[model samples]
Target chain A: MDYQRKYEKSENKNIKKISIIKYIICVIIIPTVIFIGTKLFDGKKYAFLTAVVVLLSCVPFIISFEKGKNSTEKMVILAVMIALSVFGRYCFSMIPHFKPITAITVITGIYMGGEMGFLCGALAAVLSNFIFGQGPWTPFQMLAWGMTGLIAGLLSRYLKKYMVALAAYGAVSGIIYSMIMDIWSAMWQDGVFNIKRYVACIISGIPTTATYIVSNIIFLLILARPVGRKLERVKLKADIIEKD
Target chain B: MNDKMKIFNTYHPLGLFIYFASAIVITMFMINPVMLTIAIISGIAFVLTLTDIRTFLKNLAYEIPFFILIALTNPLFSHNGVTPLFFLNGNAVTLEAVLYGLDMGIMILGVIYWCKCYSIIVDSEKFIYLFGKAIPKLSLVLSMALKFVPVFKRQYRKISDAQKCFGYYATDSYFDKIRNALRVFSCLITWSLESSIDTSVAMKAKGYGLKGRTHFHNFRFHIRDLFLIAVTLFMDIVVFTGIGTDIIDFRFYPKITQINLNAESIAVYGAFIILMFMPAFLEIKEKIKWKYYVERI
Candidate 1:
């Protein structure tokens, strides 16, 4: 019995040690896997698979949380967050504006944080594609957009005028998103990642990029003052609610 | 095992993984349209089985406006394809292009519906359980964001009802409705921002970004999970093979490929739908458990 107990304890310790090592490997390998996987496919299908892989690869990292949360509350929060993320993505297609995606993602990131930003960006692409149409590129769209949100969230800590930063990021990522998407398209459809095609894709996206920039600047310019002020007021109220 | 499901239910997680896998494999392998259609329909049917037929229809109803817009706009912008149907102000409208648009429209609607099924069944906690460890900051953000929605929704409802009480009639025209929507959205944004700051502060106080942050999750590897992983992996291989071999060739243009409409597609779709409704199935099972408990008393 004593021998068995010792063996079990040692095994548990070994598992813990391995898990940390696995996480470190994951951090390094994840982006590489996504880059390669995306390069292998094209369009919406490629995008969809990339997103799935990214989500799956993160599994080991998610398993390390401590237990005993308010289960119902936690579940409810998760549902709402996902819905928001999905809806955020959906609205990007439906809402007619150049900067709708960037504006929403940045604002959401500032308020919600990086993970939600990732979900929002990734899901918005996937969900919006349902309206635009799903194809081999859906996952890539998710990743491109999700990365925007994730970056915005990371930057929010440093930027006081979060909206302006968001607009700038949005404009840059808008171009980046199309460029990356085009590279994926070149790979899948042509079976070769063509620089000419990549350039052509980016050139084609100029109108959309311009629209995005204008929209982001205008949206942030208008929204930042009133919205930021109101948010400050609400924070005071939430503080009371939390204390109670 | 078949009882009212708590958050710990494995079925939903299994289904989530399946959804991810299928979405990946289907796109990667270039599965036939016939099979894709089968997968889409089966997913819907599975959702119907879990929720009421009426509820399913109602949920679909919400997507109609968006669907129409996508269908209409695609053709206006994309003037490609052969076999022009007519000339609208010297612009050609081709049969092939319209069909292409329709195909895209259907695909889009199908994906949205599938995602809805995924969201309804899995929820945030399960998603967090699956993703929280590797990306703890991201997980917390997602959890907080999810928690924030209904609070905003409830507050919006209260505010709108109050407006109605004061004779602020909300409906007049589409533009008016839009105006009201903007108002509500701005308010919601305000609320979210405030709460976000508070949440961030709270998290920081709790040592959120301290070195070596830890997570606690309770996931067990049971026979069922193994079964799911094995089955999905096998199906993925088969689906890819079907695509690679042109056994289920689905064409988008002038040429159309036929599928056998037989066992393989049907079975794959059947399993897909079941995976979607695993959450609802667990819920129903829970109700049955409560009923059995009362009966025993």
Candidate 2:
């Protein structure tokens, strides 16, 4: 019994190490590969490629790590999440008052972990651009939105209860997301990055940023508690099914 | 039927290489707008010869109005040129400005149409196969997204119809229509979300994105692809020669030169026109084959 326990602990430690390595790969290596690929390949086609790749990479993580009891039920939940992540942006963008991706990302982060949250943000950008049609700038949108999801997930851990902290992080996430996207635009469109280009991009993004801040706060206020409770209920229900 | 269309479709690396070389040549040589216009026209003509008028006309019908709107608006907003056409709200709209707008509008349409043609003729599977290993995430996203559209549209239409049958009227009233659209959108979004998740799960189970990656692709590159590359390079050389000797030009600004219409320029324009209609050409070929099969039956 003692020897078995020791082996289990070592196996667990190895698994944890692998997971950490994956986290590093996802947050750093993937982006670097995308960046270098962008520089070498034709810009427009490459942008489309990046968006697709990011979405594809998420498949394994989503499939293997899910805690759902039934495969069909698990699939149905994921589908809803993906739909909300992707088309939800378009729906909100049309409203003229709501920022779709930011709201979705924050909500998703609060519900799912940072990893799933990040995928939601990035996939939303890629899917939304289909309606806008693919272009030279789609990858920037993916990067920006993906980061928003990542930040929201990270911030959720620290700002677990305080509404003010939640709201502040949401607002900051919007600004940072836009900034990251515009950095690429400034480089590609203007062929240089400077204060002038930054100003131009930021000025255009005001309405979007405003909507994001408002939507995030609204979503946090209205949906967070209810969704959290529902999530708890879902876990309980799953537990019952598993015991059966 | 000749090499140019084949070059554009199968040998994209070669096409890209040619693009870089010509871009360098044009920039370095300071190619005149007139000469560039000639070259662009020739390229269009070549595209046209491969395809037909129907496809070009279709794109023109779709894109012209939007292009015109952009072109007209730009000159009104930007009054920086020397040659004034009229005064609008204390702004002098110049002939140069108007011409520039029109020129830009035409260029934008041309590029859009060219891209459309490229999408139509180039086998998307081939593109995915070529770059799948280099960028798996992108390839997967693009393939899935492209695949999603047709499925999405079909499902959306069916759901909308079902809703209508269930007394959900999608009316012309702005607010009501928007509401209706949102309902449909949300439902579709839900469906797509589920599909993507399932797909991801399946991919993962199949050992996708594994540390030791094994890719699956069935892309076939044939003798035609090689020929296409060679011919495209040859045509690119011809284009460069035209630009280098001041026969073709590309410029943007106050200097508007009259286009001297020559036979070679006309031929080049013809080539470009052929290139633009590759889709129509393929469709026609398909139809012809079907007819032949039917006759045999």
Candidate 3:
């Protein structure tokens, strides 16, 4: 039993080491792409650059999913989280910018870990776009929300410990989502990332940003505890089923 | 609704994928006025052949506004180039900006139309086949998620009804309504996660995601499909070469660049025209052949 425990600890450490390597590689790729993107690309190219960015950002999560020992239950849970988020988007489609998508995505990340969270966020963006008429903004939407989930999952422990942290994270997530989306607006307008154009886009979309912040906070605060409890039960339930 | 009515259905999924991918990528890369215009016109013209007039017109109704919105929005934010056309909020809404906006709109519209054609032709089943081998897990997830959306939508209705029965939701007070809605959402989340356990068990029992899995695809790459693919490849190469050599280059910044109508430009344009309008031509040919056979019979 002692031997088994020691072996497991070593295995866990190895896994952690591998994940760090994975992240470092993924991190290196993104800034390189961005650096090249800024240097080489101009108007019309930014749209494709954003698309390339989406692909590069998503590949790591997908690679992790492929490599990891993700059970069927976890996959289902991720799908369910995405479905719930998409449903949330559908429910409040009549109300502009008022969506539980960010809250749900954040909660998903917190429960499912960073990789699943990223997939959840990105897939939700893709699925919602499918439902809501895909446009030029779809890739950016995926990038923003996918990163939101990724960061939330990575910082899940701290957020879980403190209510204020969770709320603050939720607000920050909204800002991040808004800022990333406005990148598209800036790029689409002038074919490059001009600060003047970007700020103008942001200023114009202030109402949207406010709505995102409000909805994210409201939904996160209301749904976090319950969703966390449910996800815990779900984890337990999966374990029980797996034993059978 | 008839598959015979459209030529898009006849090609193999690989052929279809290559065509659409090349078309969209080519259209996206170029900011040339003439090139973008060709793309938009071809997309519209090709899509018209595939879909019915009424539905196309209905889609067009919103699409026109979308195009206009993108076009106008471009000028609003962008203050690039010489030749100021007008002043909007202490910014020069220059001619370059205006023209650029129009080009972006055209490019966006072209992509949308081609994608619409793609979606209409390549159903989820075909998509699964196309991407299944390359990204098996992602494809599985996509198929599973697509399946689950409707399943969960039904579940949502069931949960909402039960919640309403318990006086949980379906109230008038705004804050209360929002609270009640969240409760229903919470309830659904629990049910969904609970059900996911059962789904995973069921999927495992059925031996999903097992190694040595064989996927059944009825997509036989016939000679005609190969022919279509070859032509698409040839045209794509020609067009890409045009872009690479700056033969098809037209700019709309500072001042709109004059369109070159030389041999290289014409070759580039010809390749693009053939590629984009291939489906329409094929559909017309098919219709004529079908009519001739019917008349003979």
- Cα lDDT of model 3 by residue, A1-244, tens digit: 9988996787677668668857876778778887876775433477677777766766666666655556788778877888888888766665788998899889878876776777888888877766665556777888788888889888989978888999999899998899988888777644566787788879988999999998999889888988988887888867733210
* Candidate 3 residue lDDT tens string, B1-297: 674457678679999888888888788787777878888888887788777789899998998998898788777766778999878889999988888888888887888897777666776667778878766776677667777778777877787788788776466877776676677777788877888888899989989877787877788888988998899999999988887778877777667778999987998899888988888788778879989999999
Model 1 alpha-carbon miss at residue B62, Å? 6.1
Error of 2 at B292 (Å): 6.3
Better of 1 and 3 by DockQ: 3
* Per-residue alpha-carbon lDDT of candidate 1 for residues A144-178, written as tens digits (9 for 90 to 100): 77777677678876544555465566567667777
Relative to the real complex, the DockQ score for model 3 comes to 0.50
What class would a CAPRI assessor give candidate 3's docking?
medium
**TM-score winner, 1 or 2:** 2
lDDT of 2 by residue, A6-94 (tens): 96787677667657756776787777777775664323223234444555455434332332122433333433454554544444555
Chain A: TM-score in each model:
0.62, 0.66, 0.82
DockQ metric, candidate 2: 0.10
Docking class of 1: incorrect
Residue-by-residue lDDT tens digits, candidate 2, B1-297: 443434344445434334433432232222234433543454355346446678667756867687786568557545656778878888888887687666645544444443434433444565566556654554565566556656666787787788878877656777676567656755665455545555666766877645787766544556755664565566556654554454544333465665645876655444433332333454456557767999999
lDDT of 3 at A10: 72
Best by lDDT: 3
**Which candidate wins on DockQ?**
3
Better of 1 and 3 by TM-score: 3
